[model samples]
Target chain A: MRIRVATPSGHYRTPTYIQGKVGVIEAVHGAFRNPETLAYGGDGRPKQTLYLVRFDQTHIWAHAEPVPFCQNDRLLIDIYEHWLEPAPEE
Target chain B: MPGVHDRGGWPDVGPINKAEHELSFWEKRTDALLVLLSSADRRVIRVDELRRAIESLPPEAYETMGYYERWISAIETLLIEKNVLTKAEIDRKAEQIVEQRTIETTE
Candidate 1:
């Protein structure tokens, strides 16, 4: 249940750190108005789903230097559904 | 360029400043203003609007301004965009507030 935070241009709520990173969907926060449209004063009629995604510390720095990571260590991020894509089951 | 507010993984940007500094008096006022603006019977502004305003700031100001200053600028920007207040009026009112503060300090 990994969310695909695609790096697209324009008014976006997805933080750059979590963009393109894979994480497990820990929670579904229901639907809310799209912030990207709301930023421009337009009504975010079609609400988007927000999810709390959990990632391992090592998953975040897989490309960077290898750091000692504990199995219990995790990072959580709230992301909208539009920016997500399901990943292959682990 | 990416939104100014999205600074994650930007190598040049220094470490996250974690020092806990008490909110200044004016900062507290800004916080209160934000609450009233969004929590009032009629929602005048949304948090997304504020973030957009903060991201819309000039790169230098966006990068250098303090957290609360950023919030102030965002609030002002949103106010202007919504036609709730003009830039000139905000400028004048800011000047008056500063002048009044200085007088109160000296008196």
Candidate 2:
């Protein structure tokens, strides 16, 4: 799956680095309140599903050297469902 | 582009500082203030609101301010935005505190 590359003009949990990057879903974290609305005094209705996505460190950073933990090293982040979609076959 | 707070993979930033240090008195108070404001009983402020306020900070302040300093700054912004406090009120109160401290030092 790939994270959606959307630059919303308000509060969002997805970091900029992970946006538009391809990653594998490691776990499903269930739905939770939408922070975007909750941040602005709105009731967090209709929770969004969350997932633990894993990405290769090298894929994330051009200069990310496979140091002490080389290829096995991976970065895992929790992303909401709205920020993710199916990635095309590699 | 992501905000300045999104510095996940920037190069040449140096090693991560994992060293833990004791929280200063004001820092501890800031933490307690957040907890109290966000508590279910009060619901005065939410953690999400704080993060939003912190992210809204200008790049210079975001880059230079210490952690708790950012938190307090965000809390102040949110408080003003929510109408719980006004910029003038806070400014006047801060000036009074500073004046009191100066008087105490001289005494």
Candidate 3:
């Protein structure tokens, strides 16, 4: 899955740097209240499914430094459902 | 551009401060207030609202404030936004506190 690339105004949990990044679902963290809606005093109805996503450190930082990729290097984060979509066919 | 609160991958951010320190008196109070307000019994505020308020701060304030300072500032903003407290009321109370402190110092 790829994190949605967006810059909409308002409260969101997805960090900017991770937007548009591709990662694999490492684990499902169960449905949880949407923080974006909750931030504005709205009841987070229809909870979102959260997942632990893992991204290759080299792939994530590819646009910048060319630090050699090590299999041990991985970045993992919990992402909500709305912020993700199936990665485009490679 | 990302909001001021999102500084995860910034290039020039200074070294991470790993030093730990004892909590100040006011900082402990701020933490306790957060727990009390967000607890199930009170439900006065949510953690999400706190993060939103903190993220919404001006870039200057976001950069200048310490961790607990930011939390207290955000909590105050939420209180005002939720109509639990008025800005004027908070301001007057702050002034009263300052006056009391001044009198104590003079004495």
Off by over 4 Å in 1: A88-90, B12-18, B95-107
Between prediction 2 and prediction 3, the one with superior DockQ is 3
DockQ for each candidate?
Answer: 0.53, 0.74, 0.84
Candidate 3: clashing pairs of residues: none
lDDT of 1 at B5: 73
Please give the lDDT score for candidate 1. 0.82
Choose the strongest candidate by TM-score: 3
Q: Candidate 2's fnat?
A: 0.72
lDDT of 2 by residue, A1-90 (tens): 999999757788899888888999999999999888899988887899989999987777745564555666799999988899999899
Q: For candidate 3, lDDT tens digit of each residue in B23-98? A: 9999999999999999999999999999999999998999999999999999999999899999999999999999
The order of the candidates by TM-score, greatest first, is 3, 2, 1
Pairs clashing within candidate 1:
A4-A84, A4-A85
Q: Please give me the DockQ of candidate 1 compared with the native complex.
A: 0.53
- First chain of model 1: TM-score? 0.81
* Alpha carbon lDDT at B63, candidate 2: 92
